[model samples]
Target: MGDIALTTLGQDIMARLDEAARFSEPGPGVTRFFLTPEHRQVADLVRRWMEEAGLAVHMDAAGTVVGRLEGPAPDAPTLIVGSHVDTVREGGKYDGMLGVVMPIVCAQEIRRSGTALPYALEIVAFGDEEGARFPTTLIGSRALSGLFDPATLDLADRAGVTLGQAFADFGLDPAGIPALKRDPEKTLGYVEVHIEQGPVLEAEDLPVGVVTAITGIERHTVAFTGKASHAGTTPMETRRDALAGAAQAIAAVERIARETDDLVGTVGSILMEPNVINVIPARCELGVELRSPERGIRETARRTVLESCEEIARARGLGFEHTLGYEEDGAACSPRIVAALKEAVEADGYRPRELFSGAGHDGLAMSALTDIGMLFVRCRDGLSHHPDEHIAEEDADAGARVLLSFLTRFGTPRP
Candidate 1:
């Protein structure tokens, strides 16, 4: 097949993405999560696609759907390509699903042409990258990476269902997750194609770019406690308003993040008790998240924000508390994989642009298992995690073609 095949391939992959979007919950946009009916339906669809590509397919203990293309040697090391299948609330059609569908089409093309690969090829679609249901993220990838902390299974969701019970309800044994871990020695590498989720590529007039590194992320749940009283009865000088203290702390978070280079902080979720015009708020709870490519910069910003929050609480005579929810350190892309992707982009008639990723990805978890690489396709308006997320059809074609080029040339010595 020549370059013309890529356009047809992109159309095929886009249709599959649209089909997968149908399984989402009854909402404004896609709202699928792990261990739910939507997950089951999408898993079945993915299974059929992989099967059509002439690959053996299976769903792992953590609900990760895996497709395998055996090479000449059964025991030979394998090249892994995949991304998460889960989506956040009101998510778009191409966040995680795009990465999965494009590879399936490439696998289909590989099989159709009878191309020979030196190593076995495996395509995976992780079940829970969004963690929209479980309050935890990267369950499937972390489990496969052998870095899963089993205690996460004990954590509960909004409906109070634990991850372990949900696994059981879906007919999967949580005990088997440990067995799903891949051996580092026999694994060649992992490659993922995803949306840029930023405007750099579009601003530069590029369809795709190579990833240099992913930003590390840390999140904390903070709460402030104070006395509850009637707003009319509580005087401004005597009232210990928890909400007021929380508001001050939120501003501090923003200020600190801006002061530190490349550091971003946000307080997206917030709650207050007796949230009415006539009553003084007695408690306030919020989620504070911070991210940066450099761990030292992220850590320093986190320390400053935490201290300032506590100080504000003390001044307002409100009790303060916080708990660390999740953290994943930043990781650099493999040099070998980056070089191969760069060449692949050039081979496909596009200039390769390398940039640091401000967003987190499944590759962060996979880094613990084997080498990792990423190809970022331009998205419309740099929007993600919303219903408006989009990418051009030609851009999708570019991403898939580059991925195919990278796969065919990788795992061999380059001239």
Candidate 2:
């Protein structure tokens, strides 16, 4: 691609990203949740763009915005490409937005070139990959993959509104959710373009790379209970402090993660009863997350952390309880799809690096239904889920070109 074309495409992607940011919570940064007004507005905007690109578009009952371009044959298999559109609290603009926008841009280019593939192209802007509103992630993709359970419809948000109610309020029928599942026999595969969201790509001096796998994730909420007492009167040796037990568990998680290879554990959130300075905490609740590309190692790390927490609770004479919030196994990309992406990257004059995604993505959920692939665009300092996350324009263009190249060559008959 020439500099002019690349520049134009980059500018367009950035413009659309900025436009999406406008629908966020009324604050200094972006925050769009599932079934919220901001999410609906952004979905509408993306739907319009898909329409402008000659795609047949609709918002599914799960709130996923889907745009389809029919192949030459009516019953041909479909190739799905997309990423989530929802953002975390005070999120960056490009994390999920770029994946949705770039695919549309590629579709436009395909149309301009008058090229038709053997399979239909469907671009999806998923509604809830972040799970920022509800406790569950991948709600949209799960529905499309036929994994959505009716019971999940009763999941409540901070406002105590049921997910089913939100669906109704958004003009969608929860009863019709099953109709949204795609037929596996008619689907070829799925592809997602997302920011690297880590330092590996930038450190390697590469603009784009092919993902080998997405890390498995296990989330837990752990609570330690003990008697509250006066902070000044309670002696260190005599006190049973829940916060102290939780603090020890947190430190153990950090230690275990560092000692284990390819494993990571985080205690991202915590709450304590009797948070006042003059009182010993009676209860402490913490959010524990464990991740790794290898499922065995990930599970082992999770067990190790739980055991450590148990040990701490026992030593401190506190009651311990934990509940699993979410668990997803690591997903490997299809080797066939990875080869095609690598060829496209090399064709564009960039050496391809294979890396595992540390952060979770909608692709993790889609993998249950189809062979999935991912292309990672380098981001500045590997920052994501924050207001400061950044990606260079040229890097964005490179990702777009590689995706277009892959789409152009995929599933074509070998001459």
Candidate 3:
């Protein structure tokens, strides 16, 4: 098949992105969190678009919106395309929305060109991927994969509203969450289209990126406890300062990450107790995320950080504790899907390279029980999750074309 005409695809993609960006509009950014009114509105907008594209749409019990395009042969497993719609606080428009919209655009293009695939195509917009408002990630996909449990309902937001309560407020039944499981035999494969969220593709000047694997993520909360001292009374050498110890540990973690190849450690969030200028900090809390394409490297870096924390705490006469934040089982992309995408990218007159995704995605959860792959469009300035995050319109269209080409080869015969 010929490459998708950029003029048509670009206009459509831009329009959709613009529309989705208007939902939360929290200051110059977006903030459509789980089960919030803005999120519901955006989801509703997605459903309307799905129907407008002539796909049959339905919402599963767990609140994932699935849009289906039937193929000539009815007896076949479905090729799934999706990403989350939830955005982090003051996030960008394209981060997770592109993953869902690209599939829709592909379906529309295939319909326009009269292209037929062997299997039915299903586009899913997963809810609550960022977990910004709640503690659950991949809630929609996990529920479909039978991973969401009764305890998931107990998770509350800052306002103390439970996930189940949010579901109720959204006019969905809380008890029906577990019924969201899909027929395992019917899902043939999965694909996610997203912005690179890094400088990789932009640096390479590539049109699209074929993801080889999703990075393993290890998140932890490190707490350092030391004596609170009067700033004026305690000598600099005599003070047992928790904040000082935490700063040293954070510095060590950053240095270790820099030394380790392909490993990333972010100590983005920190809290100091008893905000007083005079006292030596009694306790300091830090949230850290460690990521690496290789599990060994990630594990080594993580272990080193914990060990360093213990050493620093002991040296400073402090108490230390580590709590796991979020641990996603690492997912390597499906070779078959990646091969298909690479071929498609080549067919579109672009070179293909194998790259690992540094960020966690909903695809990681879906990959547990289904074959999955991801496509990354170049991000301007190698940035994402910010209001300034961007991808060229042509790149958006090209990524969709790559996804269409791959989905054209996806799925297996229902037996």
lDDT of each: 0.90, 0.90, 0.85
Cand. 2 Cα-lDDT: 0.90
- TM-score of every prediction relative to native: 0.84, 0.86, 0.87
| Model 1: residues with Cα > 4 Å off, grouped in runs | 1-7, 151-161, 220-252, 269-287, 304-326
Candidate 2 local Cα displacement, residue 15, angstroms: 2.0
lDDT of 2 by residue, 1-415 (tens): 2333555777778778888889999776788888999988999999998998899999888888999999999999999999999999998999899999999989988997899888999999999999888877798888888888889888899999988899899998978878888888999999999999999999999999999889988999999999899989889888889998999999999999999988889999999998989999999999999999899998888888989999999989999999999887999999989998998999999998998899889888788899999999999999999999989988888888899899999998757
Clashing pairs in 2: none
List candidate 3 segments past 4 Å from native.
1-6, 223-244, 271-285, 313-321, 411-415
What tens-digit string does per-residue lDDT give for candidate 3 at 145-201? 777777878889999999888888988885776677767788778888988998888
On a 0 to 1 TM-score scale, where does candidate 2 land against the true structure?
0.86
| Candidate 1 residue-wise lDDT, 1-415, digit = tens | 2343454877777778889999999987799989999999999999998998899999999899999999768898998999988899889999999999999989888888888888899999999998799878888889889988889999988999999899999999989989989999999988888999999999999999999788999999999998899889778999999999999989999899888877889998999997988888999998999988789988898889889989999999999999999887998899999999999999999999998789989899999999999999999999999998998888888898899998888877657
Which candidate leads the pack in TM-score?
3
Reference-based TM-score, model 1: 0.84
Q: For candidate 1, what is the total of clashing residue pairs?
A: 0
